[model samples]
Target: MDEQQLSAAQLAEAGLDDWRQILGRLKARFRTGDPATGFALANAIGQAAAAANHYPDLTLTGADVVVTVSSPDGPGITRRDADLAGEISRLAARLGATPDAGGLTQLELGLDTAAGTRLGPYYAALLGGEVTDGEPVDRSGQVPTVWWQDPSEDNDGPALPAQPFEQRWHFDVWVGHDEGERRLSAVLNAGGRLVSDAAAPAYWVVEDADGNRSCICTPTGR
Candidate 1:
């Protein structure tokens, strides 16, 4: 086992039923009855993070407090995050908070660029995001994360050179397996083109009329 990172199976064993691990982060939502309660929980979470020396992407709005934890230098959840999550869960229990499992959704940008090392900083600066491991992410948990991909070896084959963002940057809409098809049809109805379904039930490559791409993905049946 890596000393810095914890695998998905280990995260599960750490009693993190309230949290969901996806896209190299462990995300969980705590539902409060009111805004005041929400803010209180968020504050407590901040204190907990400080104590653990591991901060989460904590967001509080209306009646929900969303927390995302991960190691800055490791893949997915780490031992530090799992321990912090345990602390947060205990604090949440004391505050009468309940888990909001369905409130989580993650977005990632797939940019086909050979010069990922060069373009990453530009997009990170442009989007007010931070670059980590050559990927740009919204560390505040407010915006979709952007990651670069080499289109030279994708299932879609070689990518074409483009004048602008079209055909290069696309979205990866992470959804539950149960909701994948519904979302796919909705996008198609919204005038998005089906680029490829060769990897269906796992991911479906989609494109807009202008050639921008997005994939509808599910967690199961992969």
Candidate 2:
């Protein structure tokens, strides 16, 4: 099977249970400013589940907690991983949490969406990001991920998260120097700030509008 196609045991390792509890703890601990970001994140979770056609276990937190990407369904960053991370990125956008690129604290970037619609307006509305102005859009991921249904058309799943931030591992996004600048520009425009920068040819640390940090570098730099 592909990297995302995992056996039942692999799915089990992703923590199907207590998803809300984890999210809640994260929210309580981090106290991200925007509370609605949690719901936006919830909607994003539903969106990803819809797209992947697979549901991730979540801990209930009265509409304040949900599962994140990072929980791998397979070994290595497979197609599924990219897809999942993309979903989270798109969803986090809605909550004002874009990719940090540098100083990453969590890396949830693998999911496999065997089914679901790639062009979903609801997801766009939730994310507040337009669909690239018609570029023959496929799935909206720089990576491969899955969703159970499209958030725009989805009316099912764990509902929205009650708050922002969650328990998970951080991830770093690698890119070329030019791409790094572009990403940083977008992040800056989105309300993300530059957290750190390396002396290398192409390396930077950025925080999303929500304050999550991640690294950015060229592909070769990776």
Candidate 3:
């Protein structure tokens, strides 16, 4: 049987307070305070996942462990993911680890192009990923997803005239709602200028001194 996909509201109602939906996956970080504790937490999560027949990707560091849960059958969150996330949270608490939801972030690449159907396959081949709905998704989750956007289409920001030899690629940094302002401030302080904020609380477009653009995005108002 296919797994039932869960929406952001459903996840919140399910009591997965520690996890946040990033892109299409549920991500959370646990501060273990030390390498030993972090390893212990990772191991515990592994065992629990095995027992439950659902696994999550774990990144262990000297002071923390980042966990990402995604349904293997598809790209969205499901009940299995929520159950595994709850179990992981319980394990973290038992191991004296603290959940850091504010620190969770996801990065994605966007290319402005009117020919999404044509460019999607090229990007997918270049990134060794697969094309889905005019976006290239990295199956390994190591590389950021590359999405094609049509400049002529009505989007969040004002549409610009398609020009040749202009920069059309940008980065989308997805952060938690509470972390949006702080991150945007950091970018601005680093000499980045605001390009647009019409999508405030949803996203803010900013460009560096060299005109390289990126977006500070939040789940709010999305």
Candidate 4:
């Protein structure tokens, strides 16, 4: 059966019961209390992934094992991710691991241009990332994935007004929506200004003193 992608509302509801939704992935940190126990929990997760044929990004620290699952080829969480997350949570429970909801942040790179096809190759080479069918992605997952955006068409009338030119590149810093205010406060304290909050609960554009821009983003739905 083809796995259906969950809407933001569904994803939020499903993940809140256990995992936390951040950007395109579902993340949950399991406190193992020790490295040995953490490794064991990692092994169990690996086995579960093997059985499901779905793997998550795993980071094992001193006493915490962070697990992040997402669709391999899509924009956001899919049914496979949600199902695998449940299984991992079950495994963590059996191993006496406690969930820590606030251990990680996901980042994505956005490049605005109408000539993405021409520009993407240069960025791919610069970042040492791969360009798959004209889309640049960090296959190693070490850095944030880059997505190119073109101006949207104005469908309100026959005349399509051109979008004003802006900075070409910005980082999408994904945090839980509830954590956005706290992070935004930190940014402002560091001399950043909020450029726009018109899209709250999804993203807020902020700029530094020099006019460089980035966004604080959450999943689209509250």
Candidate 5:
């Protein structure tokens, strides 16, 4: 029914094995191939996990690694997930991951008169990223956060964006507390229409001008 509603086994049957593996861990997916980056990401993962005293479900997919969090098993904000995201954001900054306009998942990637707008900031917030030049950003867990957008990027950078998307960059976003209300108000204040009947009062479905759907939730056991 929901992301956490599924049994680990059912999640796997749905080809969502990664989520199941992470179990209580919120997942983070990344793509890269430089040996240096791979090692860096692995190290970051370990450092964060060990530092947080929480382990994550990490899967290596070709040139990428998918990390799912297993903490904060509650409904909305899990302490572990939040802490881990902060750690990842820090790692991204240290590595110099700048926000880009390349390919991203249909979910995270959206067109907003702002180039690298929603994603860079939204993710930076979602992941607890640091500020850079007034914009928030983080590398994709690959070390030495370089654009690595075009093929001409540094050998130790990302391959621009992973093409041929079957399972592209994907992550779970949790709207917590007053921040959700503030965002909803801003969206509405900016003329963003609420998608009623999508889930009714309990869970609201709102879309941006481009028709991308983001939910407004009350994380109170639902």
Candidate 6:
């Protein structure tokens, strides 16, 4: 990692209690209680970002404001992100806003394929994003990232033959480690079945009754 790039541990040590590192971005939600307050905070955040020459993606809902910050020129969190997180927290505090850490989550799309390199460009173009390190990433954060799982790369063996009826795509829903089990339980209660838990604390594969699958993921193992 570069000296400027911050790891998860460094981000925690920075005393940013209101923020969480999700999907390589520093994300946080502030409860504004009403649309008026949400807009005010959004405007304040915009001004702060403009002054620092670093912008964060801001979403203002009817009762909350979601802020996601990342280094524009890099792929991971950096010192500037931590600084801005602190400033945003302070601003929210002054406005009597409360941080809702539990509301943060990130969704990513995963494709199981033998020809990742060949199919990457097609998905990237369709999603209006670019392929970075074998994954399609939407810089605007408007769409979930698309990653590939190439079975052939597992043990230097030949690529496995594609099955006509196999499920080729799935979703990887990332949440805080502490929130993993609750999410899994919710899925089960909603008619989803546990497909696998061999990777507990990191991820668990769950499938809907019809067989569509999604993995509830956390940062614990990877």
Return the top candidate by TM-score. Answer: 6
Evaluated with lDDT, which candidate comes out highest? 3
List per-prediction Cα lDDT, in the order shown: 0.76, 0.42, 0.84, 0.78, 0.45, 0.83
Global fold similarity of model 3 (TM-score): 0.84
Q: How should the candidates be ordered by TM-score, best one leading? A: 6, 3, 4, 1, 5, 2
Q: Give per-model TM-scores.
A: 0.73, 0.28, 0.84, 0.79, 0.34, 0.86
Clashing residue pairs, candidate 4?
A: none
Which should have the higher TM-score, number 2 or number 3?
Answer: 3
lDDT of 4 by residue, 130-212 (tens): 79878777777777778876756342212322334467788888886567777788999999988877767677778888777
RMSD of each: 4.4, 20.9, 3.0, 4.4, 18.0, 3.7
lDDT by residue (24-107, candidate 6, tens digit) is: 778899999999889889988998999988889998889999999888776688988889889999999988889988758999
Model 6, position 40: C-alpha lDDT score = 85
Alpha-carbon deviation at 131 in model 6, angstroms? 3.5
Q: Write the per-residue lDDT of candidate 2 for residues 98-122, one digit (tens) a residue.
A: 3322321222231123222354344
Residues forming the 10-long window of minimal summed lDDT in candidate 4: 154-163
Window of ten residues with lowest summed lDDT in model 5: 99-108
- Model with the higher lDDT, candidate 4 or 6: 6
Candidate 2, superposed: residue stretches over 4 Å from native: 1-32, 55-74, 101-222
lDDT for 3 (candidate 1): 41
Residue 105, candidate 6: C-alpha displacement in angstroms: 1.5
What is the lDDT, from 0 to 100, of the residue 208 in candidate 5? Answer: 56
- Residue 186, candidate 4: how far off, in angstroms? 2.9
Q: Which tens-of-lDDT digit does each residue in 108-161 have in candidate 5?
A: 222222244334565566655654543454534432111112223244411232
Model 1 RMSD vs true structure: 4.4
